[model samples]
Target: MKVEYKKASLGDIQVMQELVDPEVESGVILERSSDEMATNIRSYILAYVDGKLAGFCALHIHTASLAEIRSLIVDETHRGNKIGANLIYKCVDEAKTLGLQKLLSLTYRQSFFENLGFVEIQKESLPEHKIWADCIKCKHFPICNEVSLIKNL
Candidate 1:
């Protein structure tokens, strides 16, 4: 399973949408419009396996030293292949390249992130900009059930 992780292009939006749809529908992740994703294409990294889209992760910069990992999804058929981990690694690598000191995520899969060295944290610890920009739009809003996790880059 040769997997390549690279920055996502505008052309990859549809494939990325499909990869994330299941989680969205299940309410495990928030739904994002294709247009919104296209606009933020440069913030994303996609994983390709044998020339097919296998997974994706996005690192959205919220401040000079902080970034949030968003929209991490792996194809259902390709789960358990370490593709998700690779996508995460790509996001962390990009964060390092950009001189970011922290990466955060609001996720249901706490143990999975814990295994990757992300520590569970209080959502309030995150910069207010992140909440104002993104989380406010989330249906979960003030009642968000997702656990907040952070990793020092």
Candidate 2:
């Protein structure tokens, strides 16, 4: 399958919901509202295979030197196709473009991130306290099950 990566626009909001809702239902990812997706649409990069919605990921800057990889998901049927890895690399490319020194991922899939050159780290090692803003909306909060990893760009 030929997967094309593109920046998401506001019109892609419904597709974003369709892609993320399943992960949320499975308790693998935090739920996102269409409104929130629309508002942050530019932060997202989408993957399309044969012109169909394959998956997406986002890059969110928290500071001059740091950014987070957010909302990474590929269709269940598309698993093992490397779409997620491509999306993450896309974020890393963006991070490098913006002169970010580090990219962080809070993920349950540690080996996946580790295989992509990320190293495990205590979440507290991150300097920004504002990164916790998203925690307020997450059921996991202080007890987040996700592992924190950083890739130096």
Candidate 3:
């Protein structure tokens, strides 16, 4: 099946919300309001298959040399079709275009990221700015089990 990828727009917020809420509820990702997604819409990339929203991902830049792939979620119905990997490739290409030196992600799906060429790293090794800006606000901060994975762009 062919998948189309594009930047997330305001019109796609409702679908993105539907696709993301479950993960947030289950604690796979931090909670975000629909308004927040709408506001940060430029940071997102969406995947579509047969005109249906398949997944959403965000390339969140924190500094000159660092960026994180955030909120990457592929719908259950579309998981095995490589939609998630395509989303990551888009993020990586965007990161390269933006002159970013690295990409990082805090994810529970280590094998998924590992398959995409991301290497496991110490979460604390990341700059304090990234930790302060997002992780500190996360409900599972101190107890978070997500692995920090990185790929030098």
Residue 50's lDDT within candidate 2 is 95
Task: List the candidates' TM-scores in order.
Answer: 0.93, 0.94, 0.94
RMSD of each: 1.3, 1.3, 1.2
lDDT winner between candidates 2 and 3: 3
Q: 57-81 in candidate 1: lDDT tens per residue?
A: 8899888898999988898889999
Please, what are the lDDT tens digits per residue for candidate 3 over residues 78-132?
A: 9888889999999999999999999999999999999999999997798887778
Across 35-150, the per-residue lDDT of candidate 2 in tens digits comes to 87777888999999999999999998888998999989999889899999999998998899999999999899999999999999997786666445677677666677889999
Model 1, which residues run further than 4 Å from truth?
none
Give residue 64's lDDT in candidate 1 (0 to 100).
89
lDDT of 2: 0.87
Local accuracy by lDDT, each model: 0.87, 0.87, 0.90
Give the backbone clash total of model 3: 0
Clashes of each: 0, 0, 0
